[model samples]
Target: MSRLAGRRSAVDIVIGVVTHVTHHELFHDAARTLSGVDLEWVSYDHEDEIRDKVAEFLSTTRLDGFLAGPVPYTASQELLPPGLPVGVIRSSALDLTLALYRAQERGWGRTPVSIDTFPAEAVEAVATALDLDQDQIDCLPYAPSQSVDEIVAFHRDAFARFGERSYVISVRAAVRGQLSGQIPIMSGMPVPATIRTELHELALRIESDRASAQRFAAGVFLISDAPDEERARIALMNHLHNTPEFAGAWIENRGRRGVVVFAHKALFERITRNWVAVPALAEAAAALGARISAGFGVGVSARNCVLLAEQAAARAELAVEPCAYLFEDSGVVIGPMGPVGAALRYSYRSHGDDVERLAKYVGLSATTVSRLAALDQELQGRTLSPGELAGHLGITDQSGRRLIRTLDAGGLVSVEGTAQHHPKGRPTRLYRLRIAQALEAQPWSSPAATSSS
Candidate 1:
């Protein structure tokens, strides 16, 4: 069944497509068959303009996803915000074949041709299939570090080497300007079919993420040390009932000293700013003089969710401070969620002594390393900026940057790219946490490792 089959309302997805001016019509033609998606075009006449255009597009639009070819993506990759779904349209074999056919129509035979950006294997495969001489085909695969000048040089040198018998086929739009009149050139842009498929796939991914965020979740709030349990419970209930954030939630008393609230996980995410903090806990303590500890659970069934929430609440009670904890069906526990800077999260699942080993290797505490592991699991392969990581871990931005440096130095994180949140200043560096992989690679002298060996 389709993931979007039972959705209540049509999802309005906005996708930003960054392309050269020449390919704008191509992208639009490809998106004509798609529904429920509005494509905001960010077209650039030159590669130099891509970065500014992308930054302008992002600042003005609320895009659900982004798509660009390799050249534009590489040029402006560091400008894209984290967590925005991105699709990089590469030149497919079909695109290459079509370009070759067009070249043939123009009286430029397939042989004695120079191709750029397509993989050498793809070039070889197409050559073999068409019975063309592979020896006459010069190929240069795309690399992130390869510049426009370098690409132009490869074609120019190929033209010089092959003389008038050779023509150039390039996926890069920039090459057309450099070698247009100097040599016979054919554009190898991705065809509309390739773009259409990529657009559909990206739309489905956006919808899937939206649906997952809206899944039902339960939260259990307990008056752990109230002098008058009934009054404290009533106060907690009243506070939650009156809070605008909980207006959509079903808030009711669960026990003598507890109240349960049920709502979509997205609501909680908004209230907690993506589980960075639970201001309600502190608000209850300060405003109502009721020390409330919160436990939020997400599971398959309502009953099981409540049970997990209760368990999480008990865990929160173990803390000396008023805080909240999250217990997911996946056995990931994130807790001590008071102020953003004081919270710590760790998985309930055992990693044997890997956490300890990683901690030692990185010169950080086991608890911190474990928390990172839990965070990495929760992120599910999404890259985050240091500021976002800091917010999640409840630490200062500087501390977050320092932590990233530590993790990077210890080989536990990789630089994914940069993200520009605002229109000004330098972009923030994005990093993907590799704590789980690092922990898995940690050499442990435990019985589990020994027995497995």
Candidate 2:
């Protein structure tokens, strides 16, 4: 929400758009015109500055989502807030076809020509669609690894092979700039339909967030047992009051051993998304030498939700860690939160044939398996310490160490080194997640369940 957010009479959502290239004004105008929903758009100029621009926008104004080019979207994924929605604009087939038509209109299609804009497959697809023969086209493919000089050389070679009066088709700014004056070049920009579709998806995500924000939930904690130390109790209360997750919460003491805390439903659901808070709370209680268990309930009203959460928390205390359980208004109980402990013997629903196979092979929950796959790509075969792993998983350090041990037991990680005290006394141990190797391993009919037992 910006200063101009609710000012628009018809617009229901506010979003930000970042255009890296100058021509993005066309996309911004087109998406704004074609999209049926009333939207207030904030424009940003640089793609490389996505993180700074987005953070500033988020702080100053409220937005449902952000739109950017594919390069900016991919580069900013890890930097942006994980919960925030981002949409990427890409060039469509129609755009490529139109550019080729422009070249044809210039009478360049009549002679054998060379084109260098997209990759080989894309070039081939466009050539086929335009009914241009392979013999008449020397399609120079663009590889991401190629340097600007390499691309320039490629275009120069194509120009030499096809002779004068031919044209070079390039989408890259560098390639086009270099080929200018030396050769005739045509630009291919993304079409409005493609941009509108991406924007529509962003609007849908904003709607989803709005819907989720409206759903009310509450957490009820019952500290069934605790040490008789008054200092410990006071410390726990102070820490709870200071926690951002429990901000604006109301906490009450029931005797010396029991307590009740209430917070917004949205806060609890946000924790659930990252699988972080419940485990962090467990670790916190352990550090404070207090025995605590909590439950969360989602409903239309706060009072009923608290009562349900109390009941769910009572049930959770029977477990070892006493991780929070979620109780829906419809009477559904979800979990002992955090990563599902390896000791639990609960049946899991398979995501699909492929996911089920991967989960089974890795001896982890479907969610964990999916995250591990994503981490594999992010790490690029490099190792990460427990602290780094915690940062990656959005969990506390203790919880991250526990997860690493669980992963180790599942044969999904290789310990690369022993813990060494840093010059500053901080400890470090190198460990690599062996997800790729796990995929290559023989499929086990029954992989060890995600537990030490």
Candidate 3:
């Protein structure tokens, strides 16, 4: 039933099966076009690969949630536990089961869909909307397990079928003022444009006889060359505002002249021109003051770009922005900025702690812990109850039927969701912990070491 979703799967993206295709194609598709990321179409078999595919998705892709078959709920217990939001597509048809299996095969973890029950009629609704063969959508449930190598194979195959080659320059914009926490694309991935010329030109004029990487590091000129910071600041801003992603922006005072700039930490070493992305952004910014220039820096990884961009933007503001007559000598750096990076960094750090805690308990590699931590943290939130606490701890509630059972079983803490009290009926019950809790291990009480799950 996921006709278009699978069709566009060659370009892997952060999405789930429950999302309606029309909306998915309109918005997310634009994001992929502007950002150059794509989803892939993975053809999966229902009976042979159902379980294996689901597990593979859990291990490899960032899953939103797993879809359960009409088979008994008891059989589906350990498949994806209650720690994460999950849905069960109620379908006895083998083909429909297969679509769920295919959709399940991508990420390490994802935001679970609230539609836990996908009845046959509901599946039919999707089938009608997607113009898919209802019979084929019937047979898609069942599987065993997939190897780690297979997961890698999935990425490789998808890339081989739809990979690009170029010196990549990425300009990231937060969507709807929110961080989606989508996986950064694989390294060595090519972007749609190049930046060597702009960067090379800036390097030639910086006066310092040092290497280009060092000379252009600051995106600034000597006081002797530009005189005062204000003149330099204004001159730089005029030019940077022309580049892509700065659309509808204006220069604002920091301590000095130019505006701030940030890009992938990698861009400090290479300047990639995104001529393709300029027009739309320019229009968006046209109504605003429309002046921006960046001070650039080089970092070994994207994380470093956050701090570097802040430092560079601050310097750029003081250095003076260019106007009317100049090439693309934008004074701004290409990287993520400060203030803009607060939330992203915090989430990354918190997620890191989750990995460390889980790593000690499971004895998995640091990489696996890191990957799984992302899934765990993204799937959890404000809800806190006895079962949730236990599930969050990844411990089994083996004690008894009571809430304390979570503690005895292995649950470290508990969490709960909204529930209504039963006046004269049986006790009201909400979702329970399907995951086990943390076992006694190292502690996370200080800066040197921390623990969380």
TM-score of each: 0.66, 0.53, 0.26
| Residue lDDT tens for model 2, 287-384 | 67677677777777877877777777777788876576777664345566743332221212211223334454332344456566567766888888
Candidate 2 deviant stretches above 4 angstroms: 1-12, 34-61, 110-122, 135-147, 215-265, 270-275, 278-289, 294-453
Per-candidate Cα lDDT values, in order, are 0.77, 0.59, 0.30
lDDT tens digits, residues 1-453, model 3? 232243344333322222212223322342333221222222232223434444555566553223222221112334542223222222222333343334345431111111112333334445554565543332111111322233333333433443322011011111101212322231111111111121121222221212323322222211223455676556555545654444433334444644444433223322323111112223323423344434343444433433454554444345333211001122221222221221111112223224334332222223323433343445553333434444643544421122232122222323343455556753322333322223123322233232110
Whose TM-score is greatest here? Answer: 1
The predicted structure with the larger TM-score, 1 or 2, is 1
How does candidate 1 score on lDDT? Answer: 0.77
Model 3, CA-based lDDT? 0.30
Model 1 lDDT per residue over 1-453, tens place: 011112323467888888788887798789889887777778788877877778877787777888887667666655666346667677767889999999999998887999998865457658866899887889987655677888899998898888897999998877888899999999998899988977887788689769867888999999966679998888889988989999999999999999999988889877876665888888777766767888999888888889989998888888888888888776656666884527454444543445644564444545567678878988999999989999988877866865675576456898887788889876766889998887677633333222200
Off by over 4 Å in 1: 1-11, 78-81, 119-138, 160-164, 222-233, 254-258, 288-293, 307-338, 341-453
Could you tell me the TM-score of candidate 2?
A: 0.53
Count backbone clashes in candidate 1: 2
Cα RMSD of all models vs. native, in order, equals 14.4, 16.1, 22.1
